[model samples]
Target: MRTPLAAVGLVALGVCLMANPLFLPVAVGEPDPAYTHTVQPVGADAVAGLDSPAAEARNGSDLDAVVAYDDLDPAARAAFDRARDAPEGGFGVEDPDERVDSLAYPTDPRLGDGLLIVERDGERYELWTRTVERESDVVLVQRVLVQPIAFLAGFLAVVAGAAVALRGRLGGE
Candidate 1:
């Protein structure tokens, strides 16, 4: 009976983990000084083509084939075109996410940059993006989520310790 209960609990725990959001690839790439755009569950049909290969690749190979940056709306297209020939922005001395920003670059001359990602959780997918536009004022999103696995593991440890103590005291051979 105890073995079956443990097995059922294990299966239940696995299911819970599978449903978690932290298990997904939720990356909080560096903020772009000139970029300020956020899209969740990105619509591939509209923005995919406008995205550069670098953006597509960062999101994953599947998006590399799917994003058609050419399919973007005219205004968005113009924004990209403007950035193509724009001057490159100054690099800050203490930027930690500069490497990630390098992977996502601007297509126009206006000196903006961006990144797109397809975060996967089980059979479901979430699209996330970061765009840097050169402007005086900018608002950044805190794109981080907590991991439930660690909390669950800690809870299980406490439960297991109690169970062992109970068995030793209550069940005598």
Candidate 2:
């Protein structure tokens, strides 16, 4: 009976640990600047191509000329064309040695020259700036979750101690 009760306690503890959000790793990445813009050339071209009414008319379809850059509100569509056309690594430093070969975990954004940027959708998005500081509590929570077996062992020790104490009291009675 005591063995089954202890097993249940162990299982409950495992569930509790898994449910804790603090055990999860913080997703590290660059933070985007407020004025930054991401313009995917492929998507932009596709939108442009579709806006051509002549092409649609020639094809005998309900075609509309792709919206011109001028058509876009100046305030909403920031000047991203120049940034998009420029060569990669224009925003920040690139780590040539850092190869993204593994998919097991996400690569941490590299920091350089007070900025960290990641290229996505043919646009650079800032993930972080200046220094990347890790939260201390994140380290403590991860340390505990990393060694789940140790937690189980500690729990078993407590159960064993309790059983021994109970047995002693009963024997004395």
Candidate 3:
């Protein structure tokens, strides 16, 4: 009796994990409102300007410049990458006034078409930009773990259910 009940429970657990009916949170990404906002739609030319070296030189200080996505420092790049992976388009920024991580994926897709804002030490730098693409480690890791777990659970459930069903014939009720 107990064995059969346990088998059913295992099957239920396996199916639930596979289906993810509850929408359990996975390691998607974090959100930082400080670096996130809807931007005004601008022309592609405007975005190109943000990536120009002239924009950096015109900032009057190297500490503050409108940098392109490819030109972003390692830390800033990682943050934006995480934002791109977020389920709800979340962003991550350490400090708006000191780091480029302060940038966020535009809340609206249309807003991200061309312009982006950067701030460093109270100075706002409007930068032209385009899209950035990167794979998320969090997402990769989730798939790696879930797939195996689901397979193992399903196998065990079937075995257990069979054992319960055959217990009487096996003379081990």
- Please estimate how well model 2 matches the true structure, expressed as its whole-model Cα lDDT: 0.39
Top-lDDT candidate index = 3
Error of 2 at 32 (Å): 8.0
How far residue 12's Cα lies from its native spot in candidate 2, in Å, is: 0.9
The regions of model 2 sitting more than 4 angstroms off are 21-36, 42-78, 88-173
Worst 10-residue stretch by lDDT in candidate 1? 135-144
Clashes of each: 25, 13, 2
Superposed by TM-score, candidate 1 places the C-alpha of residue 87 at a distance from the truth, in angstroms, of 9.7
* lDDT, each prediction: 0.40, 0.39, 0.49
**CA lDDT, candidate 3, residue 171:** 77
Q: Candidate 3 clashing pairs?
A: 47-128, 50-128
lDDT score, candidate 1:
0.40
Q: What tens-digit string does per-residue lDDT give for candidate 1 at 1-173?
A: 56446545655665555454554434445433433223333344434433456546666544443334455555443333333323531222124343233334443412123443323332111222234443222112212323455446646755664565466557631
Give the worst 10-residue stretch by lDDT in candidate 3: 35-44
Tens digit per residue, CA lDDT, model 3, 31-132:
323344222222234443444576467574433434465666776555555544556444434354543444444433332333444443443334422233
